[model samples]
Target: MGENLSRRSFLKGAAAGTMSVAALGALAACSPSGAASEAAAPAAAAAGEGLAETGSYDVMSQMSLLNRNMTEGAVAAATPEEFIVQKGDGALQFAPGGDPLGITPADFMQNVPAWLGEAPEITDIAGTESCDILVIGAGNAGSVAALRAQEMGKSVILAESQTYDEYDEYACDMACYNSKIFLDKGTPEVDPIDVMNEYVRKALGHVNLQIVRDYAFRSGEMLDWMMADHIPAEYTEKYAKTSNYKGNENFSGQCAGQWSWPAMTQWRDEETNINMWPFVIRSLHTSLENLGGKVAWGYQALRLIQGDDGAVTGAIFQDIDGNYQQIDAKAVIVCAGGYGGNPDMRLDLSDSMRNLAWAYGADRTDPEMIGGMGRDGSGIRMIMWAGGTMEAGPRAGMSIGKNGAPGFAFGGAWPCFGPEGKRIYNESMYKFGSNGHLDLMPDDSLLVNVTDANWETYLSYQGYGHETMDRSSDYMVEEVRQNMADYQTGPDGFPVRSFARFGKEYSNVWAADTLEELADIVGYTGEAKENFLAEVAHYNELCEAGRDTDWGCDPQCLFPIKDAPFFASFGATGGQPSNGLVMLSGVNTDGQYRCTDGAKAAIPGLYAAGNTCGNRYGIQYGTPTAGNSCGFALTTGYCAAEAAVNDLA
Candidate 1:
């Protein structure tokens, strides 16, 4: 995903910034970081070294200074990718003036919950369940942490807030590599150094680099243990459904289990919005129980107890029966999900996120919202209250993708109707397919997309009339060209089932027959209506021409509309957009997964796993590939367990 700063404006700003760069270069000669440049600027000083009167550099130049090293080629044949890099990935990455926003401690704390102000119970209460390791939050990371510690034969107590009958609000495929399963399936072992470097280059800019190094080196062994012992054989087939995204290319060794229609049809329909990770989750539950570890399903963590010597001594929890459950242990692992489910916390982080939050029971009156998956950052806050630091920018990771609403084509141009019934963005814009979602997210204040049967037919070419074909299918590939040559017939009739239950339930998708009728229903007004009709007419002309004169729709994808009985639905994202997933950020920790103090030193007896920890991501998903979220949860949980066990020893 990228910031919405248009390229035309960025260049205008860059050309101007060049002058500022020159001026700044001259000034830097006398400053600390640019002493050598001062000697180089003598030509300017002689000609009134204050050639402050040179190029057309304007105020925009100050913001566009990431490119101060550039003279030209902002978008040369070899440099178009470079432009997006300097420009930014989203609203937060770049300042309004076009300069990168400076990193701060607050940025790291954006998703971490504020410390609860409840007065501490000063007196000691005796008699609690004693264990070698105490784990909070039994999700992906917590399960792995508990299981790993149990394997070391440590007495363990794994606690979850939801009762025995309840399940996690969301689940997905796990991303990982170098497991026995991948090798058995002929998948190669991935190179740790390459993956680590890529994480540094693309995701984390100037952030610290230790935690990732720890995971990158040991993740494979963790996977080996998972496939060999942690997972029960009965669940092996379910876990075997791995999706090796990009495995055929640069990511030849990495893989994640996929979200299959069979495994997650309810998630597909948005009725249950669950993931396949629960298979492994259940297996983990069974394995941990089988290993003589106790699980407390409805234990809500309150806070950590600190010792006079500064090591974490124990924890306080609220159990389902409304009684306090104190747990004394050698080490405590906090793996509760991040703050995606917490509005106050999210609002504290970025006011912009308020609109993005899928809050609890937010209705149609607020179409931008949905019910979050309940990652309320309780563990993150407790860890911080015990003196843990949050990671600085190049900070939290955000899930970015279409929000499963009817809108623009993510890969290339199928044409999207924006606010007024006109195509929203230049079809050529998504040519940089890497961050296309940044361009496709609803741009208008309302953030809606309205399209007709032609779009439905266009999306259908690859999948079940629309959305099923697999990314691995050859038939899906050729059909796009075939459909453009001769448009496919409209699906026998409107297949209302294709729309997710949540969209229909929330009233986000609407359909009408006549163009004006459809426009009126979706709120396209007089000017917007006129522009939309004009846009459709122009689009047909472009399709006929086999060349996009207007916005440069690809020659292969320029199918035009001219049919009746049209349809429209919201949540038409390729899959549910990344926003539907948990927003990942948390308390900063050290190489051993110990929660770090403000000075970045370890806070003894406290460790974090999964989203409670940071440095596996910065700004957004660390790896371009999917599954990094689940993979990090798994590997980091394992690594944290190892460190905590050694410390206890």
Candidate 2:
């Protein structure tokens, strides 16, 4: 067998799991629900009239769509599957062991070059501090490390760019099946071995099996500890039966394994119904403080300080007062989020998708920077300056929508009409696996979502863009909850329920009474426009036929554009798609969270956790699951702290 094929031998019995890039892209927007329709055609398709039928599906009832599409409809096939090129030869390389999928071990673990040419230099320091371990970014991953170090009685210091006292370090989503919640129930039916098996398959064997094993065995214990020691009891019950990926339960024999904090729940009023995450995080923060943990709220790690021999001793940090602070440490954990919020840094992953969720023109409902925090690119870049390699991933959890508040309704059947005026992907697969963003490239990303006026009026724009705003009187917020309730009530309910924030105020929406006019408004020109009209006509014919002969789209989403005043909405992607808006490319790490500086060696005393580190994904984001971003944060944070503590012991 080949070297890579040989490595798979050891992964056979391993039980491990964490993070799905796609799950993160869909869940990060603070919205929820999923569905895939495979049924009798909608009334509109059968009647050949726009007067009847609302095109959408019931996630609970129509699970076949989820099972069939989520499993089959990837951007490209894996293993022995034949490669079907989506674009020209210049399109993304989709070979099973290629850049957009998997790379050779040598290439993936290469050393970072000293000649990046643009990295900042570190020299003098205003003041120096020492610790047994120093951890950066007090978000999900960092918090775990700091607390775990305390458990081991190691002197630790944790730093954050934004002070939690002023701005909450929001963390709620946690996916692990080993906790008391699962173990206590005999028939919990979640197999860690099975989870790990699924995990490696999803990661395309590009991950370190050791890391998966470490997290797999420790997650339940860690979560149990958090529940018993850090968080209150009542909040634990609030966790719904969901996995990191929203629709994971639809998969056969896949236990409902995902959990969330209250505040992070979608469309709910943050002020009225408080999220338990803030409390859990704060409690951990307090535990760190009580253990005499040193936390620098406004201290930002600027560069990783390395010895001439390549041992990382510390980092150069920018203090709140604008002075440089030096941290002398035996070990360090970098946990700042990935470059999701940094548009410029995002070019590494998406040249066209340069903006993040909060960046102007991005069509997301949540106010977070692309992945989490601002896409500052600091943590990943700092390690790059120390010669750390980055994992090139096509999946950044970027499941974006054109209009209709893309976050809440990741499932509906709205046609994504490309420049060719053709259906680029199954509407459900828009963000699932279709790297349509890259294949479409410059102009194809500018595709539009054709919807009716009713979708825009009721389903879009649910609450304030920022969390600080009062949601008490926000009718949109209330309306969304009711809509969601109605949908969950079964056949008598609305076809869809959402808390989206799609409206004229978002600015990407356009309405035209005629298809020709609609095409003109969105910049469909020349043959593209001709293609657009032909597409609409052919699509109308298919609607009448009640089947998508061209793309296998669900009839539920096949409601014709025949309705006058038809609506189309666009966003910061300019209607383009992406692996995810978050800048997913970043520093490579061993499964142990040790930052690797090429094949020469893993830089000792230097580790990366959370989005700052890569390798949890081979190329695409977590496919079968979604919140791998957050899951990685928790898993690596706990594991990194354990490694550092063991060394000191």
Candidate 3:
């Protein structure tokens, strides 16, 4: 999913004298090709001429001349059009314009660099050590697990694929699109439970009930814990406000009805402990060391080691030096995130989910673009290999922009694209309709609509304290509205103002004059586009009259789409695709977090937490919710540690 930057970071720490170009050269020279001459002088001579370079090539040539000729003959038997473009920069440029035809020139060229038909083997393990409890992944869950276990007086080792400093900032200051009410001004009151429930119902069809309940019930407490630990409480408040309240008069009902309950709005404030995701990891890591718990950064867990009885006994990992080592543990907690980082695992999860991998491209660059490491689904796969059942497809704890548009920024009230982009949807509409729409539509389907009036209304509304909408709110609104209106009217209207911004692309905005045309331009067609436009037209008519019969869209709020040359752009449902944030299905465990296989479960030493355990909620995201993944990780890790200590006693 991402490149390993630990070595780079470590290399940065080396004294200037220790790290020389000579060292790099020496490493390169150690390669097989660099040492080829040592094997055989004749082979080295042949390699220089690109002839039968090695005995291996001679063997291949002798065995495959006839077969190669036959293959060539078969290929030549076809017309010139059948000839695949040979490998070269030129061939790649002209590689059969669209989608490629039967082994395209591009494919042929691509295959040239792929000398081996198989993937290269990975045989490196970074810094590894033993501990009584080993926590993999250093995100929200892993940090909590390590803290909880250490608090229980257990010797723990927390291993992260990346450094603690880098992991700490992963979420902090990394701009993302999140709908949460800011505590700055007139933010509406929202119930955490109702908001989350609606979120779950909308996102997952109320199928995974327990996960929703657990998250909702514990989220407030988690916020409190985070605040106490120095993360800003305003972050929670902001998230709740923009995401849950959506700025309606009956905010509580809107939240409760939606099954989302209030989480503290103060989470966004760095001063408040609510922004504790990063601070907590940093603090806990420091605190764990103070408590005599070991913390190893830049160590990647390669696999879980199990005894003959199949009980997890330890973990194998790679250190910064690329050395494999095994560490024994009384208990192993897999807190690595889901497959959002692993494209192949994502593809294998489900065809429907494959399209979702591109969703995060909006907020952050593609995983490939960022060279982000640590998304291999190794944690999920390791558990699966050990007979642990996976929940349904991955759930979203992140957001992606519409289509594959890049440079989409998160935050602010409503669906604000990066700086200077127009507001896409009425924030209230997100609270009222998105959950239901998400429930009914496919993952790739667009749920929100934007008309001239709605765009104007959104601009005006955001300034009225729609949570995260702040100082730049008016500017952002005006900029986006003008761009959209200009795109609708062309030169007949005023010249479109350009908002010079970094990483911003006009292509990010998909606009068309009509719903059908918009859909066609955006690659949605036929019944999908027709039905969507019909829905928009129907909604617009309702807005004109001020009543929505279908979804009870507020009449006072209805913005007409009657403006000539209507425009529609791709927008998200203000939520990431489901990416397994909380798993509702897993090994049945008691209140104590003990694993039970239903009939005399023998793995007494085994325990599960977070997404690894079974149902704790009925259905919902924050509605009537309890805890988040962090809370559960802490609680269960603590519970497991306590049980282990007592058993030993």
Candidate 4:
């Protein structure tokens, strides 16, 4: 297959009226999920309907409809063996080792995407730079890699697409195991094996245990080294003191009963107002520059250069001014983030991730700008061109539930009703867990969140991320009320992106003194209206009895809707069925942070870290703590540098 064989290219062709239904089906044979659905007549029929009627290729709509059609009368498939593409089991599942399934990377991805075409065959380069190590991307991982290599006395060059002033930096908490900071604070040390096993369990054994082991055991030392002279333990102490923590028990096992620990460390300097990760980025840059290392800002990697023996020797980079340059290095570390910025790459991985979450910082449109943040898939593609494989779908994403009424954290705790007014989730699950169910709902139907006047009381039940009940301040409650008031006072017929044209006039937030009026305001009629009222009444009953018999919500989260002036927030308030902050998977790698070939052998001089590398979190982006990704990035960058240093020596 040449350049036109990619699924994304085919969809564009179909949308442009160059392909027919038969041609689409022929292309579907290449897709793992599409191939499985082809054997099921209902799914096939729905696929045909979706393709034939729609002017453009909306794969998620087609796929969602196809799954709904297949599950209409069929029982939920209990195992992968029973149904290759399991449906209607809350979340979608696929056969293991198959496309959209867990374990190994998809077989089809062994072939690179045709869209990349071929790298520029430029002979006359504007510049040719030589370095001992070349680290692409100056984000969290690349920055560390460059600094570590330079610190190891290697001539390092850090190539970043963005300028020095515009380097993408964000503050974040990082996960580490048994750091001195934690030890001094009396935090418990965790077993690295237990952490890896838990990750494997969640990923259904789709993880690289060795790579995770590197992160699990070595991340603390990496953190300690990075934090040296930058972040102070006193800063962490101040943060701990200000936290409104009810207890560690309340936050335990928040990700579907996954074990959680106090291993997550954040640098909060409320006193000096310095952000941790940003400061770390600046510090790394300063140290690298001070060590006589160079940072080639505004240079993007175009392709990898491999030797005759198939070892990656160097790479080609394109500057913003349409100029080309070659950088030859003993080892090239690719930590240029993940592919979340590219919609086609995300769609290629999992249609769910592509259609479900909006990518963060995805507004870059320059031809030279591959992706914003580390989300440009260029680094992964360059490695793939040099024969690196990627982790297969259904890939995990980091959906740190931002959906809710503005300024409120109780979106996941309220009673949620689907389009037919049926209760969808337990609403007590973590935001991502509950929102995942909402995303897999049968159709792109309207979903609403209903809560009583005692919305503030629900704050007590809210755990993790935005917990405020332990604090004496009523400011959060007031803020939520004010935000709701502002939403209600907005003009009618506000456009909600998720809603179709028919519901454009429906203001997303609605309020009324009575349940009936609230239902009317939300456009519920006939059976839907009755179902809404019934669900609310049943929920109130459950709340009064201090138990949720229907959805089995936590008893503590069961607040009654008996109070007057009940509120209903329309659309998906728990979590939008869109791209999360970022897609967490990437090109597959070995324990040493080397991007490996299909045989799982390290490609001699290529390494990857951060989101550019994969097999860390497994099938889903679930982690033992909030900052695992950040910690893994820092650790892998440091480790990749060490590996390169040793190999070069």
Predicted structure with the largest lDDT when compared to the true one: 4
Candidate 2, run of 10 with poorest lDDT = 461-470
Ranking, TM-score, top scorer first = 4, 1, 2, 3
Cα lDDT of all candidates, in order?
A: 0.56, 0.56, 0.44, 0.65
lDDT tens readout by residue for model 4, 499-521: 11111122345557789888887
Higher lDDT: candidate 2 or 4?
Answer: 4
3 or 4, greater by TM-score: 4
Q: Candidate 4 deviates by what RMSD? A: 12.8
Better of 1 and 4 by lDDT: 4
**Cα error, candidate 2, residue 608 (Å):** 1.0
lDDT of 2: 0.56
Residue 25 Cα positional deviation in candidate 3, in Å, after optimal superposition: 66
How high a TM-score does candidate 4 get?
A: 0.66
Error of 3 at 159 (Å): 1.1
Name the lDDT of candidate 3: 0.44
Candidate 2 regions exceeding 4 Å error are 1-124, 170-172, 181-188, 212-218, 234-280, 342-344, 348-373, 392-424, 427-581
Candidate 3 lDDT tens digits, 434-544: 233233334444433344434444333321211222222233436555665555432132223222221232334444555555556544556655655565566667666
